[model samples]
Target: MARLRVFLHSRLVLSGLLAVTLLAGYLVFRYFYEVAGDFPFSQEMLLVFIGAIATVLITALLLIQQTDLELRKEGQVLLLDRKAQIYNALIDHIGEIVEKGRLDPAALADLRVLNHKLAMVASAEVIDRFSDVLARLDTAGHDVLVDEAERREIMRAVAVLTYWMRRDLLGRIDTEDEEAVLAAIKANNADLE
Candidate 1:
């Protein structure tokens, strides 16, 4: 049933139908010419046949283009959903560290896994921002004391990373926008401290 539906909806099937219709029309015209002998083919009949064929072919092309666009849109939505999941996981990991006041062994491991996933699914800009956050965390080390300034910097990095991921998920990130987001993160952190 699925195969039948696919075949019916295929562009190749439409092309085949157009070819068959043209062939059948040509055969019918020929048969009438042969049977009627001296009867001439009317220009009106020829025009009607051409017009009908044009209409069918144009309709088929439009349907095919529309189907292609719909499939692309569906695929993009799925991709964005996956990216959102990754972003959420990253945020949760960051939240855990912020709440705990130090990165633990388990959190570091989870961050590593999330970082790898981000590399696989995230945009270059997002990955770069995330990498900076990861670098800061690594420098601080597991169970190490983080000064207030260092903690604030880490928070700022995570905030900037979240902003980049959100922009990417919404398909609105620009080249200069990262700096703006980072600056906003810095300003917000200042207000908090």
Candidate 2:
């Protein structure tokens, strides 16, 4: 069944089948008109019928194409929603830690769970950037009060992660470094600090 669908979807196969069908149809019409000479319908009527069939086929093809596009768009929307939820959760969790200016055992555990969720949907760039957060936490050690310098580093790393997440959610291929975005975010966060 899958092979049949693949065969039907192949442009080369479809075009070849179309050529064969048209050839066979022409031969049948020729046989009826020339050999038997008992063509029931007038040539003008035959042309009209052919034109109507062509119109119907074209309409059906257009509808099928439109349906395929709609389905693709819907799938993208669903994926985008899922990604947004995951990204939001990650951001919120980090925000909570930053707000408290400290970490806890529970937050660390929650972060591990979020990591699994991120692994499922996050782009490589997002995952890589997010890992910096984990590394910073590890460097600071667990269940400790965050110092100003440590907090700034975390904010900068979160900014980088946020930048990558934005690109990933937008379906953009992110290859550039996030240093410039991180610097800007760091400067902004300095005022808030």
Best by TM-score: 2
| Residue pairs in clash, model 2 | none
For candidate 1, the per-residue lDDT at 96 reads 75
Supply every candidate's count of residue pairs whose N, Cα or C atoms clash at under 3 angstroms: 0, 0
Error of 2 at 60 (Å): 3.6
**Can you list the residue pairs that collide in candidate 1?**
none
CA lDDT, every model vs. true structure: 0.79, 0.76
Task: Point out where model 1 deviates above 4 Å.
Answer: 1-13, 16-20, 23-61, 173-182
Instruction: Assess every candidate by TM-score.
Output: 0.70, 0.76
lDDT tens digits, residue span 1-193, model 1: 6744674568676787778877777777777667766656554476488668868887987887787678778989998899999899898888778667787778888998998989988999899999899888877665465556667778888878877787788776476976786688768867886
lDDT by residue for model 2 over 24-73, one digit each (tens)?
65766666667555656655465566556556655655665667668778
lDDT of 1 at 160: 81
Model 2 spans > 4 angstroms off: 1-17, 35-40, 172-183
